[model samples]
Target chain A: MNPIRQDFPAFDGLARPLHFLDNAATSQICRPALEALVRFETDDRSNVKRGVYARAERASVAFDDARKAAMEFLNAPSPEEIVFTSGATLGLNTAAHILQERLQPGDVILVSLLEHHSNLVPWQLAAERRGASLRAIPVTDGGRLDLERLDELADRVRIVAVTHASNVTGAITDVARLRSFCDATGALLVLDGAQRAAHGPLDVQELGCDLYAFSGHKCFGPTGIGVLWGRYDLLDAAPPFLGGGEMIRRVSLERSTFAPPPHRYEAGTPPIGGAIALGAALEWSMAQDWDRLGAQERELAGRMLDGLASLPGCRIYGDTGTQQRIGVVSFELEDVHAHDVCQLLDSDHGVMLRGGHHCAQPLMERFDTVATVRASLAPYNDGADVDALLNGLEAVRRKLA
Target chain B: MNDALYDQAIIAEARSRTGAGRLDAPTVTAECDNPLCGDRITVDLAVQDGAISDLAHKTRGCLLTQASASLLARYAKGGDVAAAGELRAAIDAFLKGQEDERFAILTPVRNAKSRWDCVTLPFQALADALADLEKRG
Candidate 1:
């Protein structure tokens, strides 16, 4: 067992052991992040950037440090490129809202079939508002983006929005290849990093994406705080998504001059404590050996996939091949509803799994099933968790069958 | 073997229900889909003398939903459309942990709070079918 599991309070708080397999939905916060949140709230609680008092100055410094931490986490060129929003949903929506100005009528905004609704709906609304068309990259039978079809939309595609790792399938997109494709086509790439952020460290420059967004809650940080990393040059040119206090440099009744790149995008009092805790979360994550963590997650995922495949009527979704996937596995038992599967697992064995369309209806249509029971792994999970899941699933099949 | 949600009676009803098909030309038919879980139930009714003479259903859902549809089909054959419409309220009460005698077979589902819709979707569709019957008349 990894010693990091002891750092999470949830494992110790429960009377009985809980096999938390819903890491894709949201991860349990680590001790450092939780303490950071409490420390900010109890001691240094003050609104940031607007006050001249000592505590307020401390709060402002903490807030700016959070931005710097996030910038370093993403390996973004500068702290100016990081814009704080509520979560990935707001970050993607802000990206779409800003990009709408550059879109012309008949222009295409290409999205993948495997995107969570957060990534898909924003681009859809952007297309509708700008009179640009929206297109979806088809998913192959193995539940990966069909990269060969990139040339088909090369002429008119202004933006290519895709998930770095699918929340449903766990298939990691080849973003480096995608970057080459976008470069060849003169299209900007927007990567949704909500599911990928916790799995490993990310370098925005290496990925060559114009914009990247991720939610804090999904990555062992506090909720209501997320980062939107855009290239500084692009953010400077894009219009603001929201208008209010703190985002403006100077405001009069007649007109207001907006603040520079990041501050202009972050309108109003942001999530102060949550952002600080997120910084702590990233710092804790950076201090760890990610190669070991990745290997542990992959081993857990492999154990789960191999166990599920051996079952009589199980149908696992996505690239069942062990190579390029994160620790997420989605599957369905024959003639069994996913909700029932999950409910039984919860009630019987204290195993928690996510059961639904996973907010990817297009991908659901591709699989011709409405929903699947998903068990996502994190660094904290061990082989015992996989055994618990397998035992619970076997019991469910025997009883329900 | 000791699963409270999928007991022997519920599993038996789910597996052996004769209401697993559609009526060719029914008096009224209604379909409802639980978008959250993608569970769908379609109810077909054949009314005679203002009462349901025959009830058939097709369900693509969990065992609870299939069992609920089976129980509803078994009881709704001789019941009037008005009584059939009232099953929704009765099932809703049962799902809320209340002991409604009308839907007593579905008592197992009361404990599964997150899956209440699975047990009630079929009844909701039956209610809709009854309403459609009244609208046509």
Candidate 2:
């Protein structure tokens, strides 16, 4: 376990010593998960829960094992509660549609301003379909969710969908507290763990949310496979999201009966290969020494914050030095456009970072910035990455000055 | 990944640029923005007797894009309108990583085709402005 740069294969061949600071968008694939993907496609190529042959049976068993692995990853009560969709957006959309269909007109749906479009848009569409009211809990200048506002909206709020950590600001929202409030108000709580699940432990039981959604790709797994964990009773009560072969128990001209919890939510052909790879990714992440990784990333972020603070006209956004914050830090320099900075960093220094609104327009609107350059970190990133960024910023400053 | 790309000389040249090509008569100018990256470029040209006599640009983008904008400013200067169109064509070819037998005209832009748009933002902006000028004329 080389704590500095194990798990990822990209760090090996990088001559310029790639400083990947775009983990908020996507993670560099881990070797174990990549190997699992290759092995599954090359050696064990078969569709799960179909065909009666030995290969098919083996594939079925592998898929079932992956489900159980995902269950354990989220601390789900049962493997049956996990439903695999295309990704977090799809999972969130599925929950929104299903829940909205159940709601009558004038029902209230509450969401926070810090949500990613994946978390926000679904509820908007759902509210539109049901003619429901959509309320957003505001954020302070510091970017934390205003917990006091939640009490006002909780009484009428039917489904409270929020992100555990904001993608843009890296601000962590206390979903556990939200869940308690929602429980008292008799409102269903849905957590978007897409940004937080990769960095730390996630337990549905501990978090106590009625439903949770997360994507696999952000956690070093293959794309096109996302998890939707729901309470068994809630899932049992909801209507089927998609209809087809796997999700159907019986079909007739009169009426069709759907399968149990997980199966009912998962319709059509699932991302069998992706699910298996995700299971492998989860296993790899679980084996890591998180205390070391967390400390290293925080130290790196601290250095970045300090470096940016010393520069003239450099403004750091969001909660910089907050313990609950993720590895991402967004900032802007006066008279120096973020794209210009990112281009200089990438083409000249090979210091890859993201520069934009980071798909959280509401957060950007909150911060009053058109865009910010974000340098997000992963476990494999070291202090050198932060140093390279500082050097690149100096060059950018000199060029713009 | 070359230090030469970020060399102080290049940065200084980019920062302290005055103008491009021969001085001439009425010519069009244009600007563009990449909303995703927030890169911006403004191009100015002087066209006389249907030939480009002078070209200049002010830009805020990555080094690659600014470098390309500088090259475009040089190439667009002292060229006929037809030649400017030809330069655009050559640029399209260069962007696709295609070789134009007219290599000398494209020497300043060679090996930069991978990020051609970043470099040629000014050229495209000017081309569009010239098209509008022709429509008005």
Candidate 3:
């Protein structure tokens, strides 16, 4: 087994050697996160914010500690900046809702074609509600954002929200250029960090984004938990997204006052166990040697790219090189539908992959294809996983196409 | 696992491409997409006296979807306009584990739940065409 594979329980007892290449969808839970989840559920199970008894207090502390962990994981300025959300979808929605106050009529919400629908739809709704228009920074054939068009599209733009890294193409956005554009144009920057969070810890401060959103499930943690980190002043200024329980300072028959920053965003009882386990997952990621794991991932991704290229009629999307990209590789064999390839890969060879538009129909349109077979990699993935997919594709082509 | 899902019969059906192109002029045309996998299918029908006189389709989808479209063409060409809906319901019931020899080639697909939409896409387009024809007259 690969050394990193030992950390993932999904690899513990497999009927066959598992070739899990769909990390972009969700990474398997690490031992630390699973243990933390079980510990919270078994020992300190209680609703937070209202309960003051022993177990409840323990749960509250654990939840608070998890927030602090998330803050540290993002290199956020303060724990108050981290708001617990159900997932990145809810996080971006909250970000969009809060930022809706800033949008005026005739303003533009600048997004890119590389964004997953989670990042695009929220801004679109905000634009529609505020009587603002939506403009997109076009995608290059290489699948990277066309930053050259920023100056043209930056007019009257209030919020510039885009993916930190593409879920399908694995193309990392040039955030520094985008940040510069935001600074020059006086627009708020929001990053959908769902894909990048799976790679390693992030520095939202250094990235120069006003709001950052990421899902816990993609980062080796349980589902139903995620983080939305923003500057304290900005979060404090924006009105609460959801109105209930802990998010309010006081409730009356008529008007009610709201709580402070993080609490202002977290309504009703939050997913305490899921949040704590997400914190544990982040902490575990922090403890690892990312430089080493990243190098391994790059090599594996390179192998996948090269092997696919060797096969005739194989067309790959996004950057052909490993530079400025992660381990996610989307491609298709000529005359073969993506789902057919995926089905054969999984059923015959135990090689998992994702197919179809991957929630980025605009990008698919840009690529001029409806679907592609995607193989995403994580630190636990090894060369065997890549080879399994490469070998399986040949069989798929012979049998199907 | 390999032979079951993409059984030889299913593969041949998809490869057959029966009624694969769009009709030159059709009385009714309907288009639908598989929400799960983004498979798109367009069906053109020439209905006469509440029966299908001619049928053709353009499909951009997985093998299952292509095969399903082919099966629809083979089963319902020159049949009554209601055959599309009947076949759709039968396939739905078959996918839910009821026996129907017409759909036995698709038995392997029953275990793969995600592909259900792919297989049912063309039937939906045909039904949509029928509904549009009904609304027209």
Candidate 4:
């Protein structure tokens, strides 16, 4: 396997090099994907699906090819099943608006506490609009989704949107179990794959999700582009989210006929450069050896966790084992503000990490803390990064003492 | 980690409790907080002859916030209640660039001018608490 650090170019310019542990917020762009973005704008710039000229036709083909490649990347049933939106927020808002319209008043929408606010707020708006009952599937004490309670609540649920991995706690959920539960209840299952898509293998058919949404930027592609993979039948049945030029087949003063499936959801000029870059990113990701990447991160996380545990008053949250979690690890120090810890890491050790509620406010309330300092890893992160964070914390503790 | 932000003297002040301006002694102490950035301060003062006789503060957050509270505590001890209110305006004007020389004495609190809410958080709590104290007496 190629050295994972070689995949990213940003690290080459650093002096004494800083360790970046904020991948959950956004991953550093890979060199190949950045090149793809530049090539698209410089060499192949044209409006897609419209112009009959050679350049326009070529652009259209590139756009369609990227869509098809994304379909293959997600193992989606068809190219038409994917709808490109601005990002996961827009995709989820579209899903929520459509689902809310379909569900009658008094129907139930069951979400989980583990969901990001993007996933939770949209559904809450929908539930409030339709007078639907909203329920939260409890999380286990260890931070896993409580499947036992889910079985009991299944009958009342109309839609179940869950995070495949927790952003704060780094707890991985059992998607197959969730799928089975949703299937038995005849409820639609939507997976928030924003955190899982690049890190883990995903097959929509295998996961049994009716719809899945993930952002391109979080997976080393450019921002402002994301993909929503829905079963073709569901896409056909759901109402279009926005109306504009590209989404209609015919228009008249009186009435307009809408286009089919993916185009029906894509209303205006799409993010052509972003989609092309994302396709390149997916290509790079697929070529990687998962075993090496996962093992390296797991080993790095274990070393960090062990070092943190050895500290006098360090307290960690969620699952510690790599088998049950992702690369993101969160912890708090006794009598020290998380912000202080993050500042010290950056100033003293050149380690960049996130310290705040992480937009997981409910999780913070559940854990009974105002905030936590999180260190998330990418494939490029090595043992040195882990050492830097631990040593920085030790220095902080000594100075504070 | 920068000495300019958290100097040794500031750390020493934070660690010490004497004349820390803790309001626990006041019969009508007031505490205020800026929940967004976690800056907090409690004001302790004794009012006699319809004038401010004593004032002090216990503060935390950035240096500017602490320094602003320290400045307020010093001036408020002998000023009348109206004078204390007037000082808020002077500080607000100084923060807004109405008086440039006034800023020199308030340099430690200048960084928070852009982040006005943080710098004035302690003063806000003290003002409200003082109003409450006057109401009760």
TM-score of each: 0.96, 0.81, 0.98, 0.85
Query: Chain A TM-score for each candidate, in the given order?
Result: 0.98, 0.96, 0.99, 0.96
Which residue segments of model 1 deviate by more than 4 Å?
B1-3
Model 4: CA > 4 A from native: B1-3, B13-137
What digit string (tens of lDDT, one per residue) describes model 4 on residues B14-107?
A: 4553235564456457888766544567787777786877777777554445655766675676788887766656767777767645334454
Q: Give a tens-digit lDDT track for model 3, residues A13-124.
A: 8878989999999899999999999999999999986787999999999999999899999999999999999999999999999899888999999989998999999988
Interface RMSD of each: 3.2, 3.7, 1.6, 3.8
> Which docking band does candidate 1 fall into?
medium
Task: Compute DockQ for each candidate against the true complex.
Answer: 0.59, 0.25, 0.71, 0.23
**lDDT (10s digit) by residue, model 1, range B1-137:** 32577767778888887578988888889999998878899999999997998889999888888888888887787788777777888778767777777667677666656778888888889988887878888
In order, the B-chain TM-scores come to 0.91, 0.70, 0.94, 0.72
What shift in Å separates residue A281 of candidate 1 from its native position after superposition? 0.6
Cα misplacement distance, residue B6 of candidate 2 (Å) = 7.6
Q: Predict model 2's lDDT versus the native.
A: 0.78
For candidate 1, write residues A1-401 as lDDT tens digits: 55787888777756787789999999999888899999999989999988899999988998899999999899999999999999999999988987889999999999989999999999999999889988888998888999888788677999999999999999999998889988888899999999999886789998999999999998889999999999888899886779998789899999988999899998889999999999988988888899888888888888899999999899999877768989999999997789888988988998999999999988998999899999998888998899999999999898775
Docking quality band of candidate 4, CAPRI definitions: incorrect
Against the unseen true structure, what C-alpha lDDT does each candidate score?
A: 0.88, 0.78, 0.91, 0.78
Deviating ranges (above 4 Å) for candidate 2: A1-4, A252-255, B1-94, B97-137
Among incorrect, acceptable, medium and high, the docking class of model 3 is medium
Sequence-dependent TM-score of model 2: 0.81
Clashing pairs in 2: B22-B53
State the lDDT of candidate 4 residue by residue for A222-260, as single tens digits.
899999888888888877789897899899999888999
Clashes of each: 0, 1, 0, 0
